[model samples]
Target chain A: MKKSSKKTGIALLLILAGVGVLILKGVSDTGVYYRTVSEVLIDSSLLEERGVRISGEVEGGTITYDQQELKLIFVVRDLEEVEKTMKVVYIGIKPDAFDADV
Target chain B: MVTLGNLSQSAAFMCSLLAMVLLLTGLMRNDLRFIEAGRRALTGVAVFASMAAFSLARLFMTDNFQVEYVASYSDRALPIFYKATSFWAGQKGSLLFWAWVLSIHVAMVAFNTRKETTRKNTPYIYLVLAAIVSFFFLLLITVSSPFEPLAYVPKDGNGLNPMLQNPGMIFHPPTLFLGYIGFTIPFAYAIASLISGKVDPDWLKKTRRWNILSWIFLTIGIILGGQWAYVELGWGGFWAWDPVENASFIPWLISTAFIHTSIIQERRNIMKVWNMSLIVLTFLTCIFGTYLVRSGILQSVHDFGATGLGGYFLVFMIVTAVGSIILIAESYGDLRTAHSLESLVSRESTFLFNNVILLAIAFSTFFGTIFPLISEVITGNKLTVGEPFFNMVNTPLFLLLLAITGLCPLISWRKASINNLKQNFMYPFGLASAGGGVMFGFGIREFYPLMAFTLSLFVSATIVLEFIGGARARKKLTGEPILLAFPKVIWKLRRRYGGYIVHFGVVLVVVGITGSTAFKLEKETTLQRGEVMNIGDYTLQYKDFNSFQDRNRTVYAATIGVVKDGKAMGDMFTERRYYINAKQPTTEVSVRMSLKEDLYLTMPMIGKNDEITIKAAVNPLLVWGWIGGTFMVVGGIMAIIPSRRRRLAV
Candidate 1:
């Protein structure tokens, strides 16, 4: 083999090996899909406790807050081909401009 | 006031653009007359922009409600100080402010450096600055004009946002702007050098201290922003991976890398390409950061409005990016390192690694900050990439960087002997390992903190060893006490040793972050008129509440007795206030800060009949972060100051 090729051959091999190790170390979360509130409401039990952020436009006039418990309940609408709405319960006090149309 | 403001700012904008065209045409045609004309036109631009700023400030001070920007951001009720800060409180005025700064910096650069450099080089530098000023001035004229008037002038105007009515806000934007504007000087100089083919050490030496000044201001700006967030937002965390925060941070990172690696280029005639790339990247990132803040591609705490300037910023970015790419490609031959690597185990290699890691961190942060935009383009989904993602990715990277910092100082330049390496690092490594062991033994399960603390100990030990070694060497030669020898050694090598002290400050900051984030204790309490809550040997007794209305705002205050070790330490008051004209609520946090920890109390909200709810936390070593930040700023100043002995002797 040529000098540079011989020197780089081991380095390339070590890099590939390291990649293989990292591949094994990382779990495949690719199949675990992310769904919006309306999409998940169709099969809520399937995503009961899995990690996801159900994002949609916060529906106007559907936000209610309990100052005592600091719980906020709001309806989020998915404005896809078919308009669908889902209820979201948040525990913390809402930020300013939270009630505005998203 | 409004009409005059419009006239002056528009005049400035047109003048700057006219000057930029003149400079560009002059450089292209090699006409001295056009260059002189360009300089005079730019002077007009500077004068007009300053006059515009002065007009706006005058209107704000006098509470001139006829002006729309003044009406939107300032009021008769606001104090003189807050009224002054109204200059940057809105989009139109902030753009005007930005234009003002750019013009002044450009004017300063033109005056100072025009005579020193060649005529050809001087024109190019002037053109670069004028081009930048033209873009911003045009932005001011077209998209977000501060001089636009309201249809109907009301009796009262909306006041400043209560959250922004802090001491930090007054200084933060200017410092950050100084940093952002300061980068343009070196960038313009570099482009000027490339065009003139006077790409030598002369320009580099001329711009080095400017680089340091920009980096230092940017550093302090970021820390002040964090302090603002911690105090104003009451988020219980200092940095939240916010887009605006990331925008400032990226340039700071690149500037830091530039400052360090430029030393290599200066002394050893190496890393020339790297240093040049860093300067370009720093300036480009400054523009990119301005776009991120002003474009509204991402939502942030710092957004004024998304406005009509997104397309302008995007087009400017593309043009600048393409231009810089072409320039860098053409200048590749001039930037190749003049020397070869002598060894892998050397200061050179360490700097290479440091640059790589710093750039990697910068890339990761940039990716995270703009990930939402990219993801939306690719997948048609807007996903929030929050603190968790950044913390996860950056924690290990920072730990590795800390390891590099710990080891880099010990290694010699060009080449290092294995024996010398071991002799330098063995004790520090052993001490850090033992420290790690003790922390692990004490049930520290978090991998990140344990690693951070371990690496911090290693870095601290290395700094200590360097100081001791230098002091001892000085004492041996001069036959003086250690204290006397220390100052003598520092005087001789202020830049190098001062940098090491700054790195020591960074170590302390990292340690403080690790301690505060991992070991803080928090609790939420709802109390009646008279009640007490005990947490971690401190008792917080809820006392009476008070309500007061001022000209600026109405304050709903929470009185509490802070008792530690069965004795009353002091009484603290936290408030949730309503600024009347703005109609916004702001939280005022009360913090009892010390060397060890901070007793932080935030009044999240209040109810009718004086029922107060507070979120209180005992955050460990939170104060040290501020202390370390102060040290970083102080060390930077020390590096800039000429040595007292040298000055005296001279």
Candidate 2:
């Protein structure tokens, strides 16, 4: 019984190590920093050369899509500070919930 | 006169309480009369619950705005089908629907176990099931009652959510509920065994079919939900690692692990404690999944409005967890394995590895789903774990699982010799390598996709080899033709072969996912009339735009002409619809599906200058996922059906 459990324990430990390595690699490679528009505006350098997802409200009537270039340019207003706005340019299909005030 | 709906609700609530009391008394005093009375009360609960569900359906169909649930979820403009399905659209009605389904299972259990021999565990099963039903009844009758009448009737009612107006909604929720509620039966049986001190294989024999049924439903439910998200949400991707989706998936992962491990328990009378705890966890996850959807503690696209039921569900979860732990701890001495591992590389160890990987996946999913809450509570910052996290972490683990799926069948039970291993794996390994070479020659360059395809080929080869070897053996034994012997051998070993087919189906699904994710091409372009966008060998020309108003919504559709290899094929229309009553807009995607690939197009927005912004994707091998799901369900059913040999033995 002792020998068998020791074998099982070693197997489990090896598996756990493998999982740990995968998780570390996964988190480092693909993890995105999530921030609000105000946070990004406060420190724009925080997102330099890194992928970040910023949540904000789409300013009404300020959306334009250049069909020829497939470029979408819109103004996103900060929810907390409604007077501050940022011009965002995206080159993809709009999400279904993109129209909502985030 | 009291309305039949109200009366039925009250009666269902009362009967569930009475059944709980009687069953508890019967379990405590060892009395048969009280147990029988409890069984009758369970039947009463089922009847009243069904009546209550039907009454709600009738109210929705007849546009009875006097009821708050009907007023909130249905209107005269709603179709009759959605009106009927609206029986589970909201919290109140969904709770009642849950109770109704639970009562049906209880009544079936009561009726089927009427024999004296089966009565040993029936009272405890009754107690567990009744306790669950009583909780739902308590929630329904006090907090969220579908039968509650509105104080004032409005001229018209609010319609169903525009996103839920699709045909998928009609079947998705009920099938998912069927799966979610189905876990309760096996759980009740597990608890019954623990309480009765009869931790034998008999309980497993009685509950095996229920476990399979629940797993199948969950598999179907998750697939249907993915399909719905793919088509309705207008995102090119199907799975987004959403919280609500994870909530459903966690339970599925646990239950899947339980199902496999229980086989060991049934065969070797081992893993008894593990099986019981896994079932308990699965049941808890089911309730937790429901709680996550209804409580709105986590923000998700699929969540309903938040309610006060979070506290109730949390309390119930804690109590059940504590109680189950104590019970299992008390029964630890009786639940030891009759046999232990003989070798590390045997089928038993393989199963253990599989269970570990499955539980690890479940743990990661649970962690990722709650990371935002955890981060906020600790660091005061919300952290979101997106698809990349899930895909990155789970891909290698899934690949390992797929590899094991091919290897487990070839390995011997107690021990396997190196020669036996080589004899089984040599051919499949060679074929897989050759197949990988061919795929690489054909321009499959990505590491993950190549690995997924190669591993899938290996698994498929293993399945084919097994089938061929089995058939040849049967032919030699019976003097039958190989083709005839193949099916005969499969029928003779239905459970084993059916599992192989299910594994093959998983291979197909993995192939589909890897192909679609790695090789898919997406283009977002704006085109004027008579202008064309070229992608691969296909060209999409903007032809015309049209707008029309129906009773419910106004649709703006863009017609795009499809041209393949310089030849005009046809036109596909994609639309953006604005629902008038719901004051919401939804994208209606257009998909041209084929065996090789799907051409998916959606018009997310139109420019002010009359130019259309279109998103197009060519997703390869996507159809195989649905086909694989179908095969999995069919194989599950095949496994469920008892064989002639077993029948004769019985």
Candidate 3:
């Protein structure tokens, strides 16, 4: 083998080792935190115990806020027409248009 | 507001149709008159498209609720400046804006090349470009017309998305579109060269500045988007590995690699095939990225609404990919590398390695992005490929890329001695070690951050060493001070020195990102009036709550007093405004910023009585990301300035 080929072989081995190590590390579930409301509704007990996130549109006339404590209470509707509302209690600052969506 | 509902749309459509028809006739008959007619039609298209866009903007600024786009994006309450910015805040308007930009760019290319000679096959190129333009213009008129009138125009319409109201929107879309559509010019040129059997280096030289212009715009656009996210998105971070964000970044990486590789071709007549392929791939990625973001193929905060154009884009991408490969294969003889690699340690080999790694990263990202769609298609399972997948695949590769960035500048063009390489790299290595030791002493023990901080230090050290070496050499030879000598060195070799500055800026950005991400602190608390919450070293006291009604919005605000080290700093008032007519709730984040960190607070929820809870984030060194981005923009501009010797480089 040529001298350059030997050097490239070494580099390739090192890169391959790195890739192997990374793959062996396995995939973490933290990357994708997406779940539809319908999916969560089917298995509420599975996720309700964990600090997981669920997203849906806020039901009209169901959102209440306390400016002093910076707490928001709302009901997120599963379907646009149906009144299947899930109560959401968040202790954080709300986006400006959150109330306007209602 | 100027009215352009039907007439201008028809004019745009007709002009594009006429251009395409003329191009086809010219290609078929090999007639110069038909080609000239095609060129004139392109100019007419430019005029009509610009008028349509300008009229749309005027309607937005004047608060013309009669226009559906304006009614949807702007309200009577918005200031004229923000109203103007709402031009690209939504789907229909942004697409129209994109079409307008493309028309202008295409027209400019046609007008500038009027005096040039084509190698008997330029009509084919014009035909391709004209056909592409017609597709967008027709799409604009048919599906997503910005000029369509609202059937039942209420007293007011829904306002622009509050997230897009920042100043970043004004510059981000234009700069990105400039970069995105600008590549089409060079891609068309490549196709023309391939068809005309002219495989000369002149095409590359001719499009050199155009390449740089697009690259620069892409850089600025990415930076602007990051800045907007950091300041506006209350997320306390810049890059979130969102699908839409990655789409823009992938093209940038490939284009940057191409930029570096093209230098060898221009200098030594090597890597001809690689340059051509890079241009084509970069253009395709740009188009694909636009489709990804605008087509709603992925669920992202940054993505727009779904449209029928998704399938159209998929078909178009397939056709372009297959057609380009066929063209390359047919011209296989001309596509070979003009020079062979002599040594693995040479600059050429390093560039090749960089290209391989960049392309790997691109492919990996592309796979991750489209995997969900593939999964849905194959298994009928809608799974999300999120931040975890990207961080797993891309982070390590980018870290290696950072190391390569340090090494590429030191390696000789053909070959270099080990001693010489060691001598060049020693100082930077020492600086990086010292930086890592400092970080370790400061209580940072995380593995990835530690490596990133060390690599960033190494990259910065290399850039500094490069500048000092060049300036010292010039100073010794020309009797100039280091400060005065630096600009002269830059002027002498704009690409070399300006690129080093850009690298330095990149180092700063990576450092800022690492610091903010790894060292960020956040907490959630519920506090009553006159009650205080402690997070990190700052004390936040809930002071007052106010509710009021304005002409357009109902405002609910929280007045929180921020105290650092038990000393009163300032009061930050966060608000949640409800636009009454549009029935949209928008958030306004309040922040206290310094050079070292930002105290970002957002009012996500307000209670019925007086209690409240705020999401406050302490993000460190985030401002430097914006500063670094600005530096990069400056460096790109400096690099493009025409020197005394190369007047046509611009």
In the order shown, the candidates' DockQ scores are 0.21, 0.49, 0.32
Residue-wise C-alpha lDDT for candidate 2, range A1-102, written one tens digit per residue: 667656876997898788878776766676666787888888889678356777779998888765566667899888788887889999776665666355
lDDT at B633 for candidate 2? 82
Off by over 4 Å in 2: A2-5, A33-91, A100-102, B116-118, B608-610, B644-650
Assess candidate 3 and give its TM-score to the true structure. 0.89
**lDDT, candidate 3, B1-650, per-residue tens:** 33564567668778988988987787678777888888888888889988888888888877788888888888877766778888888878887788788888888878877865244656656766777787777778887788888776668757766666678878988898888888888888887788777878777877777888898899999988887876677666678878887788888888888888888887778888888899999989998988887788787777776977787777778888888888877887976764566678988777877777787788767777776677568666444566666787777887888888888888888887899898988998988998899999998898888998899888888787888888899999999988999888878987788787887778778777877888899977777789888888899999999999976678889999999997999799988777655445666778787789888887666665677767888988877777777777777777777766645745
| TM-score (C-alpha, index-matched) for candidate 1 | 0.91
Task: State the lDDT of candidate 1 residue by residue for B413-516, as single tens digits.
Answer: 97889899989989999999999999999998788889999999999999989988999999999999999999889878777787887888898889789989
Query: How displaced is residue B392 in candidate 1, in Å?
Result: 0.2
True-structure lDDT of candidate 3: 0.78
Residue-level lDDT tens digits of model 3 in A1-102: 667757866776677566545533423333233455666677787365423455567777877876655567988766443455577888656664465244
The best candidate in terms of TM-score? 2
RMSD of 2: 2.5
**Candidate 2 C-alpha lDDT tens digits along B348-419:** 888888888888888878877887787778778666678888998888889988888888888888778999
Interface RMSD of 2: 2.2
Q: TM-score, chain B only, every model?
A: 0.95, 0.97, 0.93
Q: What shift in Å separates residue B98 of candidate 1 from its native position after superposition? A: 1.4
Put the candidates in lDDT order, highest first: 2, 1, 3
- Candidate 2: Cα lDDT at B241: 88
Clash number for every model? 0, 0, 32
Interface RMSD of each: 5.6, 2.2, 4.1
List the candidates' TM-scores in order. 0.91, 0.95, 0.89
